[model samples]
Target: MLEAANLTKKYKGLTAVDSYSLRVLPGRIHGLIGPNGAGKTTVFNMLTSLVEPTEGRVLFRGEPITGKRPDRIAKLGLARTFQNIRLFKELTVLDNILVAAQIHKQYGFFSAMLGLPSYTREEKALHHNAIRLLEEVGLAGLAHHKARSLSYGNQRKLEIARALALAPKLLLLDEPAAGMNPNESMELMGMIRSIRDRYDLSILVIEHDIPFVMQLCEHIQVLNYGQLIAEGNPEEVRSNPEVIKAYLGRSAEHA
Candidate 1:
């Protein structure tokens, strides 16, 4: 559903991502893994056009989206979460989701201001969808709580749930398991897989949790020094000599 071809990003004399390329197929999960400073997040930025690529292009469902405005890309059914948890800390958890879910509203400002029937209908729908998403992410009971009041792991889940409010066809998750424990990560894997099947969308996740990515993704890509060193299934990548040397050993604590 998403294809990034020969993506490269350079900041001054340093190359962050060098000729990186990968594809995410419909209804499947893909993983991008690398050690620190390997430019995995750079690839995500280039793909979503948050940072313009120095070279190469990104295609979503066969159409070129390289250099498009991030909001425009999002409107086309692509959504992503950041490596660091980002939330409307002051807003209620339900409001945070409603903010994203309302992006699909069909009514105009004047309609909303005037409280037209169209605005009312769409607003009602958005509210229902927002609550449903909260339930899916196991945050239903905290719907009215401020985002900042949630625990670290719960904040992560809230971010993912907010992304889902976009109704994206493809989701890019950067380190969704960053602060979770083993059992929590395991539960996250199940949630991610279930969401993929339930929503019928593709997912590309960047994570340091080796076991988490290995078991969750059907395909994996490894990067080191801004270049892809290996791309394969879990066992194939786990046994790769270069991948082991460049990243596996460093990430063994998570294994």
Candidate 2:
């Protein structure tokens, strides 16, 4: 459902993301893994049009969306969550989702000035949809609570809920399990799988947690030094020599 061809991103003398390409098929979870500074986030930025690719193109289905405005890409059914949580801290969980749903309603001066029947109906429907989304992500009890009041894991769930409010065909998630404990991460894995099947979503996930990605994704791509070095199913990627080397090098550094 999504494809990137020969994508590259550079900043002056440093090449952040070098000629990389990948495909995400409908209803499957695709994993992107790499050590720090391997340009994983840069790829996310390029695909979502947050940062213009220095070279190459991104195609949603068959049309080129490279360099399109972020809002335009979002309207075309692409949505993403950041590695670090990016919620409106002061807004209630329900309100955060409602704000996203309201973006889909058709509005004009007449609709606002006269309070047309269609406007009222749309508003009510959005509220219902937002409530449904909150329930789906297991945040119904916290619906009226400030976003900042939720625990870390619930915050991540809320972020996913907000993204799902966009009704995206392809969802890009960056490190959904970044700060979670083992139990939370395992629960997150289940949630991701459930949502993917329930919503018929195509997902491209960039995560550093190896075991989590191995168990949750159908395919994995490994990146190192700003380039894709390996791509395969879990076993193939896990046993690959280069992937082993990358992890081993990092382990040695920590030791």
Candidate 3:
């Protein structure tokens, strides 16, 4: 559902992402893996238009969206979560999600200003949807709690749930398992897979967690020195000489 063709990025004459390309098929999980400085996040930024690509373009369902603004991209059904947890710390979990669902509101300004029945109806629908999303992410009981009071892993889940408020066709998750312990990570794995199927969406993930990424994604793309080094299923990537030499060994042996 998403494709990046020959994407390249340079900053002050240093190339960050060089001709990186990958495809995320419908309803499947695709992985982007690389060592530090490999430009995985740069690719995500380019796709989301947080950074313009120095060369090439990105396509969503065959439409070129190379340099669209970040809001435009999100409006067009591309949603994502950051490597670092980002939440409205003081807001309740339900409010955080309600904020995101605003992007899809349809009532006119006249309706809003007049407190017309239409706006009120839309507001009620959004609130219900937000509550449903919280439940889907396993935060139903904490809907009224302040975001900052949740554990680290629940914070991550809340971010993902908020992203879902956009009703995206493609979801990009950067380091979804970054801070979780083994049990938490394992739970996240199942949750990711379940949500992908439940929501009927494609996912592209950039993660340093080897086993987590391999086990979760249907296809894997490996990067080193800001270039594509290998692309295949889990076994092919793990046994590839270049991947093993560049970063896979350390990843495999990592606790």
* Clash counts for all predictions: 0, 0, 0
Comparing candidate 1 with candidate 2, which one achieves the higher TM-score? 1
For all candidates in order, the CA lDDT equals 0.92, 0.91, 0.92
Query: Candidate 3: worst 10 consecutive residues by lDDT?
Result: 246-255
User: Whose lDDT is higher: candidate 2's or candidate 3's?
Assistant: 3
TM-score of each: 0.96, 0.96, 0.96
Q: What TM-score, to 2 decimals, does candidate 1 have?
A: 0.96
Q: Per-residue lDDT of 1-255 in model 3, one digit per residue for the tens?
A: 998999999999999999988888999999999998889999999999899999999998888888888888899999999998889999999999999999999998899999999999999999999999998989999999999999999999999999999999999999999989999999999999988999999999999999999899989999888999999999999888889878745543451
Cα distance off (Å), candidate 2, residue 160: 0.5
Give one digit per residue, the lDDT tens place, for model 1 in 1-255: 998889999989899999988889899899999999889999999999999999999999999999899988888999999998889999999999999887778899899999999999999999999999999999999999999999999999999999999999999999999989999999899999989999998999999999999999999999999999999998998888888879546544444
* Comparison by lDDT, 1 against 2, better one: 1
Whole-model lDDT for model 3 versus the true structure?
A: 0.92
Q: What TM-score does candidate 3 reach?
A: 0.96
lDDT of 2 by residue, 74-96 (tens): 88899999999999989999999
Candidate 2 has a TM-score of 0.96
For residue 88, what is the lDDT in candidate 3? 99
